[model samples]
Target: MPNINILTVDDSVSMRLLLRAALTKEGHQINEAEDGVAAAEWLEHHQPDLVITDINMPRMDGFGLIEHIRAQPRFRDMPILVLTTESTAEKKARARAAGATGWIVKPFDPDQLNSVIRRVAH
Candidate 1:
Protein backbone atom coordinates (compact mmCIF):
# COMPACT_ATOMS: atom_id res chain seq x y z
CA MET A 1 0.00 0.00 0.00
CA PRO A 2 1.12 3.53 -0.65
CA ASN A 3 2.08 5.66 2.32
CA ILE A 4 -0.59 8.14 3.39
CA ASN A 5 -0.66 11.12 5.69
CA ILE A 6 -3.07 10.81 8.62
CA LEU A 7 -4.26 13.14 11.33
CA THR A 8 -5.23 11.29 14.51
CA VAL A 9 -7.24 13.07 17.21
CA ASP A 10 -7.68 11.69 20.71
CA ASP A 11 -7.49 13.03 24.25
CA SER A 12 -5.69 10.04 25.69
CA VAL A 13 -1.92 10.25 25.36
CA SER A 14 -1.56 6.49 25.48
CA MET A 15 -4.08 5.98 22.69
CA ARG A 16 -2.32 8.54 20.57
CA LEU A 17 1.03 6.83 21.15
CA LEU A 18 -0.36 3.44 20.30
CA LEU A 19 -1.92 4.72 17.09
CA ARG A 20 1.30 6.47 16.16
CA ALA A 21 3.32 3.31 16.59
CA ALA A 22 0.89 1.13 14.71
CA LEU A 23 0.41 3.50 11.80
CA THR A 24 4.10 4.26 11.54
CA LYS A 25 4.83 0.54 11.32
CA GLU A 26 2.43 0.45 8.35
CA GLY A 27 4.46 3.25 6.70
CA HIS A 28 1.84 5.95 7.18
CA GLN A 29 2.88 9.37 8.40
CA ILE A 30 0.80 10.49 11.38
CA ASN A 31 0.13 13.83 13.03
CA GLU A 32 -1.24 13.66 16.54
CA ALA A 33 -3.73 15.97 18.26
CA GLU A 34 -4.85 15.89 21.88
CA ASP A 35 -8.40 16.89 21.03
CA GLY A 36 -10.69 18.15 18.29
CA VAL A 37 -9.70 21.73 18.96
CA ALA A 38 -6.06 20.92 18.35
CA ALA A 39 -6.99 18.91 15.29
CA ALA A 40 -8.88 21.87 13.89
CA GLU A 41 -5.87 24.07 14.42
CA TRP A 42 -3.66 21.60 12.60
CA LEU A 43 -6.17 21.30 9.77
CA GLU A 44 -5.93 24.99 9.14
CA HIS A 45 -2.39 24.52 7.79
CA HIS A 46 -2.21 20.90 6.67
CA GLN A 47 -4.27 18.41 4.72
CA PRO A 48 -4.05 14.73 5.46
CA ASP A 49 -5.28 11.81 3.41
CA LEU A 50 -7.42 10.57 6.28
CA VAL A 51 -8.52 11.46 9.80
CA ILE A 52 -9.06 9.12 12.75
CA THR A 53 -10.64 10.63 15.83
CA ASP A 54 -12.16 9.84 19.19
CA ILE A 55 -15.67 11.15 19.81
CA ASN A 56 -15.49 12.26 23.42
CA MET A 57 -12.97 15.05 23.86
CA PRO A 58 -12.61 18.41 25.48
CA ARG A 59 -12.86 21.76 23.60
CA MET A 60 -14.45 20.00 20.63
CA ASP A 61 -15.69 16.52 19.95
CA GLY A 62 -15.27 14.32 16.90
CA PHE A 63 -18.70 15.27 15.58
CA GLY A 64 -17.77 18.91 15.72
CA LEU A 65 -14.49 18.19 14.00
CA ILE A 66 -16.23 16.21 11.30
CA GLU A 67 -18.66 19.01 10.73
CA HIS A 68 -15.81 21.46 10.64
CA ILE A 69 -13.92 19.43 8.08
CA ARG A 70 -16.98 18.94 5.93
CA ALA A 71 -17.68 22.65 6.00
CA GLN A 72 -14.40 23.26 4.25
CA PRO A 73 -14.61 22.61 0.52
CA ARG A 74 -11.08 21.25 0.37
CA PHE A 75 -11.74 18.65 3.05
CA ARG A 76 -15.34 17.76 2.30
CA ASP A 77 -14.51 14.43 0.77
CA MET A 78 -11.63 13.48 3.00
CA PRO A 79 -12.08 10.15 4.71
CA ILE A 80 -12.87 10.53 8.42
CA LEU A 81 -12.98 7.52 10.70
CA VAL A 82 -14.39 7.76 14.22
CA LEU A 83 -12.40 5.81 16.81
CA THR A 84 -14.11 5.89 20.15
CA THR A 85 -15.19 3.68 23.02
CA GLU A 86 -18.83 4.61 22.54
CA SER A 87 -20.59 1.90 20.57
CA THR A 88 -24.22 2.79 20.64
CA ALA A 89 -26.27 2.76 17.44
CA GLU A 90 -27.38 6.29 18.19
CA LYS A 91 -23.79 7.46 18.39
CA LYS A 92 -22.90 5.72 15.16
CA ALA A 93 -25.82 7.29 13.41
CA ARG A 94 -24.88 10.66 14.71
CA ALA A 95 -21.32 10.21 13.51
CA ARG A 96 -22.50 9.17 10.07
CA ALA A 97 -24.78 12.15 9.95
CA ALA A 98 -21.85 14.32 10.92
CA GLY A 99 -19.95 12.99 7.87
CA ALA A 100 -17.74 10.29 9.30
CA THR A 101 -16.72 7.76 6.68
CA GLY A 102 -16.42 4.87 9.11
CA TRP A 103 -16.36 3.87 12.78
CA ILE A 104 -13.99 1.76 14.86
CA VAL A 105 -14.22 1.07 18.55
CA LYS A 106 -11.34 1.77 20.89
CA PRO A 107 -8.73 -0.89 21.69
CA PHE A 108 -8.53 -1.28 17.97
CA ASP A 109 -6.51 -4.03 16.31
CA PRO A 110 -3.51 -2.68 14.44
CA ASP A 111 -4.02 -4.91 11.42
CA GLN A 112 -7.68 -4.08 11.23
CA LEU A 113 -7.01 -0.42 11.63
CA ASN A 114 -4.47 -0.47 8.83
CA SER A 115 -6.84 -2.41 6.65
CA VAL A 116 -9.63 0.08 7.25
CA ILE A 117 -7.29 2.93 6.49
CA ARG A 118 -6.31 1.32 3.22
CA ARG A 119 -9.91 0.70 2.28
CA VAL A 120 -11.03 4.23 2.97
CA ALA A 121 -7.97 6.36 2.20
CA HIS A 122 -7.08 4.75 -1.09
Candidate 2:
Protein backbone atom coordinates (compact mmCIF):
# COMPACT_ATOMS: atom_id res chain seq x y z
CA MET A 1 0.00 0.00 0.00
CA PRO A 2 1.09 3.53 -0.62
CA ASN A 3 2.20 5.66 2.31
CA ILE A 4 -0.76 8.01 2.39
CA ASN A 5 -1.40 10.80 4.82
CA ILE A 6 -4.73 10.64 6.70
CA LEU A 7 -6.65 13.07 8.81
CA THR A 8 -8.96 11.57 11.40
CA VAL A 9 -11.53 13.91 12.96
CA ASP A 10 -13.55 12.77 15.94
CA ASP A 11 -14.67 14.21 19.25
CA SER A 12 -13.87 10.99 21.08
CA VAL A 13 -10.30 10.68 22.22
CA SER A 14 -10.43 6.92 22.24
CA MET A 15 -11.65 6.77 18.67
CA ARG A 16 -8.84 9.00 17.48
CA LEU A 17 -6.24 6.92 19.25
CA LEU A 18 -7.69 3.72 17.88
CA LEU A 19 -7.48 5.08 14.36
CA ARG A 20 -3.99 6.44 14.77
CA ALA A 21 -2.65 3.15 16.04
CA ALA A 22 -4.43 1.05 13.46
CA LEU A 23 -3.75 3.25 10.44
CA THR A 24 -0.22 4.17 11.32
CA LYS A 25 0.71 0.54 11.73
CA GLU A 26 -0.60 0.01 8.22
CA GLY A 27 1.93 2.61 6.99
CA HIS A 28 -0.27 5.69 6.81
CA GLN A 29 0.63 8.93 8.52
CA ILE A 30 -2.17 10.18 10.77
CA ASN A 31 -3.25 13.66 11.76
CA GLU A 32 -5.99 14.16 14.31
CA ALA A 33 -8.67 16.78 14.99
CA GLU A 34 -11.04 16.90 17.94
CA ASP A 35 -13.97 18.37 16.02
CA GLY A 36 -15.11 19.61 12.63
CA VAL A 37 -13.74 23.12 13.27
CA ALA A 38 -10.34 21.70 14.06
CA ALA A 39 -10.54 19.39 11.08
CA ALA A 40 -11.20 22.33 8.81
CA GLU A 41 -8.28 24.24 10.22
CA TRP A 42 -6.01 21.25 9.70
CA LEU A 43 -7.20 20.90 6.15
CA GLU A 44 -6.33 24.50 5.45
CA HIS A 45 -2.75 23.79 6.47
CA HIS A 46 -2.30 20.23 5.26
CA GLN A 47 -3.62 18.18 2.40
CA PRO A 48 -4.10 14.52 3.18
CA ASP A 49 -4.74 11.56 0.89
CA LEU A 50 -7.97 10.79 2.74
CA VAL A 51 -10.12 12.02 5.62
CA ILE A 52 -12.02 9.87 8.12
CA THR A 53 -14.43 11.73 10.38
CA ASP A 54 -17.15 11.14 12.96
CA ILE A 55 -20.73 12.16 12.30
CA ASN A 56 -21.57 13.43 15.77
CA MET A 57 -19.29 16.18 17.03
CA PRO A 58 -19.55 19.63 18.56
CA ARG A 59 -19.11 22.95 16.72
CA MET A 60 -19.75 21.29 13.38
CA ASP A 61 -20.77 17.79 12.42
CA GLY A 62 -19.42 15.45 9.76
CA PHE A 63 -22.02 16.46 7.21
CA GLY A 64 -21.20 20.12 7.67
CA LEU A 65 -17.53 19.34 7.28
CA ILE A 66 -18.22 17.46 4.07
CA GLU A 67 -20.18 20.39 2.70
CA HIS A 68 -17.38 22.75 3.59
CA ILE A 69 -14.79 20.60 1.86
CA ARG A 70 -16.93 20.02 -1.20
CA ALA A 71 -17.63 23.71 -1.61
CA GLN A 72 -13.95 24.36 -1.95
CA PRO A 73 -12.67 23.88 -5.48
CA ARG A 74 -9.41 22.35 -4.31
CA PHE A 75 -11.12 19.77 -2.12
CA ARG A 76 -14.17 19.09 -4.28
CA ASP A 77 -12.90 15.69 -5.32
CA MET A 78 -11.27 14.74 -2.07
CA PRO A 79 -12.25 11.38 -0.62
CA ILE A 80 -14.01 11.35 2.76
CA LEU A 81 -15.02 8.33 4.80
CA VAL A 82 -17.51 8.72 7.63
CA LEU A 83 -16.35 6.55 10.50
CA THR A 84 -18.93 6.81 13.23
CA THR A 85 -21.23 4.83 15.50
CA GLU A 86 -24.20 5.97 13.44
CA SER A 87 -25.59 3.06 11.44
CA THR A 88 -29.02 4.37 10.55
CA ALA A 89 -29.84 4.15 6.86
CA GLU A 90 -31.11 7.71 6.84
CA LYS A 91 -27.94 9.06 8.37
CA LYS A 92 -25.85 7.15 5.87
CA ALA A 93 -27.91 8.62 3.07
CA ARG A 94 -27.40 12.08 4.47
CA ALA A 95 -23.68 11.51 4.54
CA ARG A 96 -23.76 10.39 0.93
CA ALA A 97 -25.76 13.46 0.00
CA ALA A 98 -23.16 15.59 1.69
CA GLY A 99 -20.41 14.00 -0.51
CA ALA A 100 -19.02 11.19 1.60
CA THR A 101 -17.30 8.45 -0.37
CA GLY A 102 -18.20 5.72 2.10
CA TRP A 103 -19.25 4.89 5.71
CA ILE A 104 -17.70 2.66 8.34
CA VAL A 105 -19.49 1.97 11.58
CA LYS A 106 -17.48 2.31 14.79
CA PRO A 107 -16.04 -0.69 16.64
CA PHE A 108 -14.99 -1.73 13.21
CA ASP A 109 -12.62 -4.59 12.53
CA PRO A 110 -9.02 -3.44 12.17
CA ASP A 111 -8.60 -5.09 8.77
CA GLN A 112 -11.91 -3.70 7.57
CA LEU A 113 -10.87 -0.22 8.59
CA ASN A 114 -7.64 -0.55 6.67
CA SER A 115 -9.51 -1.79 3.63
CA VAL A 116 -11.81 1.24 3.70
CA ILE A 117 -8.84 3.55 3.89
CA ARG A 118 -7.09 1.84 1.01
CA ARG A 119 -10.18 1.93 -1.16
CA VAL A 120 -10.61 5.69 -0.76
CA ALA A 121 -7.06 6.93 -0.37
CA HIS A 122 -5.38 8.19 -3.49
Error of 2 at 61 (Å): 0.8
Per-residue error (Å), model 1, residue 59: 0.6
lDDT digits (tens) for residues 1-122 of candidate 2: 78998899999999899889898889888999999999999889788888899999999999999998888888877899999888999999999999999998878888998987777777
Least lDDT summed over 10 consecutive residues: which range in candidate 2? 113-122
In angstroms, the error of model 1 at 42 is: 0.6
lDDT (C-alpha) at residue 106 in model 1: 77
| TM-score per model over all chains | 0.98, 0.96
On residues 1-122, what C-alpha lDDT tens digit does candidate 1 reach at each position?
A: 89999999999999999999999999999999999899999999999999999999999999999999999999988999999999999999999999999999977999999999889886
- Which residue segments of model 2 deviate by more than 4 Å? none
> In model 1, which residue pairs have backbone atoms overlapping below 3 Å?
none
lDDT of 1 at 11: 95
Instruction: Look at candidate 2 and tell me the lDDT of residue 27.
Output: 87
Q: Rate the local accuracy (lDDT) of all candidates.
A: 0.95, 0.90
